[model samples]
Target: MKIAWLTLCAPLLLSACTSTQTVGYGPNLEPIPGSITYGGQPRTKLTKAPVGSIVPHQFFDDFGHRVYETYVIEPDRSLRLTSRRIDYDIFND
Candidate 1:
């Protein structure tokens, strides 16, 4: 009886722990200003990088904000923007 109950509950507990939420924005999303993909998705595909690879890009935006973006290479050779971080030089660093 205990083993049967454990077996029945195990799948529910495991499924609850599995994450369905994405880490960040999905692919082909409208780019936000100061992001690397603000203009559009890059024409060059990440042919060399493997799927699920994390790529980092950094640059300064039009308003002088430093932008750092993280992307994951997809199976189709497109990049999915995962997360973006912006830092303003408030202290002139």
Candidate 2:
């Protein structure tokens, strides 16, 4: 019974933090990815994403200085970092 309980909960524990979350348009002004403008009006209405797109991406500040790279944060508070210069797949290839 104890083994069964641990087996059932193991998947639940692992699944939650297996994803990446993104922060956009804060002090680090990454280009609003997938952003669209409603061009038919006098005022352009911008539609911004809530973050976390797996799209090959990059970041910059409002002043256009490259600052951070996208990453997945582990539940243990470790970083799985990504960047244009470092292709993680290169090793696999």
Candidate 3:
């Protein structure tokens, strides 16, 4: 009887020890990539910009949806946006 009880309770105890918590951004909360800037300058890089170099930029928007833009460094040390996209929540779908 004790062996049978242990077998049944073992699964329950192991399951309880496991965590189902989610980490990082949720499905609804997505990350939007913004433009890239080097130092305090916009569309400008301190070093020579390569064709496929990436720069990081941060900004906040008033809208609820997340807005992001991606920029690629040009040979001229300038930044150009390759593409832009927006993430929004839709109801009544």
The number of the candidate with the highest lDDT is 1
Give the candidate order by descending TM-score. 1, 3, 2
Candidate 3: worst 10 consecutive residues by lDDT?
18-27
How many pairs of residues collide in model 1? 0
lDDT of 3 by residue, 1-93 (tens): 999999999988877543332212322333343325324336435485557686544353355444455555667666655544544444311
lDDT of each: 0.70, 0.37, 0.50
Off by over 4 Å in 2: 21-55, 58-93
Top TM-score model: 1
Residue by residue across 58-85, what tens digits does model 2's lDDT show?
Answer: 4443433333454433343333344322
Q: Is candidate 2 or candidate 3 better by lDDT?
A: 3
Candidate 2 pairs with clashing backbones: none
Off by over 4 Å in 1: 1-30
- C-alpha root-mean-square deviation, candidate 1: 12.4
Candidate 1: what lDDT? Answer: 0.70
The better-scoring model by TM-score among 1 and 2 is: 1
Candidate 1 local lDDT, 7-53, one digit each (tens): 99999887754323322555554556756566877888878888999
Q: After superposition, how far is residue 65 of candidate 3 from its true place, in Å?
A: 1.7
Q: Tell me model 3's lDDT, rounded to 2 decimals.
A: 0.50
Question: Looking at candidate 1, what is the lDDT of residue 88?
Answer: 55
